[model samples]
Target: MKLEDIPRLSLGFLPTPIEKLERLSTDLGISLSVKRDDFTGFGGGGNKVRKLEYLMADAVAQGVKVLITTGGHQSNHARMTAAAARKFGMKPILVLRGNRPDMYQGNLLLDHLFGAEIDFLDPDAYFTEINPRMAHHAAEAEARGEKAYIIPLGGASALGAMGYVNAVKELAEQYAAAGTATPDYIVAPVGSGGTLAGLHVGCAMFMPKTEVIGIAVTGSAVPFSERIAVMANAAAELLDYDRRWTADEIRIENDYIGPGYSIPSEAGNAAIKLAGNKEGVLLDPVYTGKAFAGIMGCVKAGSIAKGSSVLFIHCGGSPALYPFAGLLTSDLKEDQAG
Candidate 1:
């Protein structure tokens, strides 16, 4: 099937705006622009909306009424999935890692606002048993005579990643309309790696001149390149693209993953503040913050050459920022302590 032949829901604001990072560009000595996937304008807005457009389309086609998925407590995916499910008149069940916090903040707070039925898994079993937990939810929904559909963590499935494949085509059109060549680098965060996989496949097909760069947000025991290649090849198979990718073909930098998943890093927090102060753009500490820090590191260290035309795919997670307000605003506390 062609990329366009895949089923999709028009759930997000497509062709999200690409804006030049004027201030940051000057600061970094590079021509930088950000593709604002954060402004997709649906289901709380994020890059997940792109994936959910395809994933939810399948659920709608199958007449599924209950959407089951799993993720971290601050998972932008889970929050957006919940919003998508509710908007489509389906019940959303989120099986999240980590115990329920006393105060729901960030994505967890938004998930609650979406009225999603939430289950908290013990951190011990969150990695080993999340799939089964989702399956259990499906079974329960089945027992209640409700049809259920399961979306993998971060909607990382091949069908879901096709959303980014389509996005590449949209991006190509935008650049062509502006009479610009393809960007030298396309940078984004890598959590589940689905978005990065789609980017790789899409770049190979639609924007060969552009290099896809993934900054790891999660510390995985498995190599990101290997996992991303497998997914990219699978997405390519959907379009009969015929190109099989080796792990080495995938470019992912893991230097930015400080501490661990969901834990804010010093560099990430600094990046978050920089982007906010420089661009008035909000980036979550968990994902985009770290990835932006990677971009800063790459540019400063001469990995990405000066004056390179770089595009950062700003996958949205601003909602996750609220949960870290205290950590992020400690400097303010010294002066404003009332």
Candidate 2:
């Protein structure tokens, strides 16, 4: 089936703005632009909304009443999934990875505000225990006479990746309308690998000349290139496209992850401040900040030549910034004092 035939809900604002980061471009000595997925304008807005549009549409078609998903405590995906479920009059249940914190902040606060039913698991148990049991939880819901649909962490399934496929198409149109050349590189954060996978497939089919780069937010527990290739091929299969991707096609830089997932790093914190000060754009420490730091690192390493055209996909987690206010403020003050 063609991608056009796939089920999708029109939940997010279409064709999110792609703007030039003029000041950042000058500072980096590259032609830099950002695709503002943050402005998707639903449930705090993020790249996940694009994926949820397709995922939730399937839920609606399957006559699901309860939607279940998993993520980290500060998961932007979980919060967005909750909002989309509520928008469609479905109950949302989130199986989160970390234990409940003493205070609700960032996406956790929004998850509660959305009235989602939340359960927590120890970080270690999240992978070995909670993930394996989600299907059982869905079956239990079915036994209760409620239909349940389970979305994997980050909505990383083949169907969800279609959102990014569609995003690349929208971006191509925007670039043409604005009379700009296609970027040489497209950069984004990689967690569950769905967004990057979609971009890989979409770029192969739509913008074959461009290269896609995924900056790892999670540590190297899994080989992201292999995972991304599998997702991309799966998405291509869903669209009835004949193309296949190899793991080598995916280029990932792991240096910026710093400590581990969700833990803020010095380079990421600095990138957050730089984006805010240079272009008046906000980036969350967990994802975009780290990914942007990778972009800067590439520039500094001379891998991305000066004046090379580059596009950064801002996947959006600004709401999560509130939880780290003390860390950010104190660090900035320290930098100034130093």
Candidate 3:
């Protein structure tokens, strides 16, 4: 299956801009740039929009009338999926981990605004229960004479990863058009592994010289690396590509994850403020901020040479910032003081 032959819904603003961060580059003594997937221009603009383009296309192709997905309370994937479903005139059901919050803010608020039917579950039970619960919901919908499509967490399916694979090809074209060198490193956050896996495959095929790094925001590096390989290979097989990715191809730095998923860290908060103040780019505390912190840490540790070119894939989670206002403000105060 050639890429052009694959099913895809024209949902996001394609060929998202790749802009050089002059200020950040000057500060870090490196050539730094960012790929703004955040400007995808749908459902509050996010990287998830890319995956949904393919996932929703498949859903529509199968004559699905409803879409079901699972994720955390503030899941960008869930929020974007709901918005895409609404755009395609399909009902969306989100099986979110965590109890209903006292207040709906950020992506949670947008999920409600998009009219997604949300079913909240205990955080502990979420991992174990969400799959069965989604199946049950689909069964119920079937009984009601409705067709349903269930999307996995973060839309991390073989088809979904095609989004980022396409993104990498787009970035390569952008670089060639702009007469810029291929980045020495391409950095992104690893949540459910699809994006990173896609990047790994895409970079290998399009920008073979560039190294792809993943900042693990949710799990340990070892397991996430394995997961990425699995996802990358699966996506490759779906595309009828003969290449197979290995765990050795995945380089993930787990140090920046801090406390845990969705929990703000001092380093991540500081990185968020730094990007905002220096480059006028907003990064959410959960994913991009931590990944950027890892990038900064690599520069400070001499792991990334001063003159090497680095490109950060800003996956877009700005809405998530609203929920971390208190934590971010406090960290900003300390970051400013020292």
TM-score of each: 0.97, 0.97, 0.96
Each candidate: RMSD: 1.4, 1.4, 2.0
Off by over 4 Å in 2: 332-338
For candidate 2, write residues 31-57 as lDDT tens digits.
Answer: 999999999989989999999999998
How far off is residue 141 in model 3, in Å?
0.9
lDDT for each residue of candidate 1 in 1-338, tens digit (9 for 90 to 100): 99878988999898899999999999999999999999998977899999999998999999999999988989999999999899889999999989989999888888999999999999887888888788889998999999999998889978988989988999999999999988999999999989999998888889999999999998776899998899999999998999888999889899999998999999999999999999998899999999999999999899899999999999999988898999999879877876
lDDT of 3 by residue, 78-147 (tens): 9999999899899999999899999999999999999999999998887778889999999999999889
The C-alpha local distance difference test score for the whole of candidate 2 amounts to 0.92
- Residue 271, candidate 1: alpha-carbon lDDT: 96
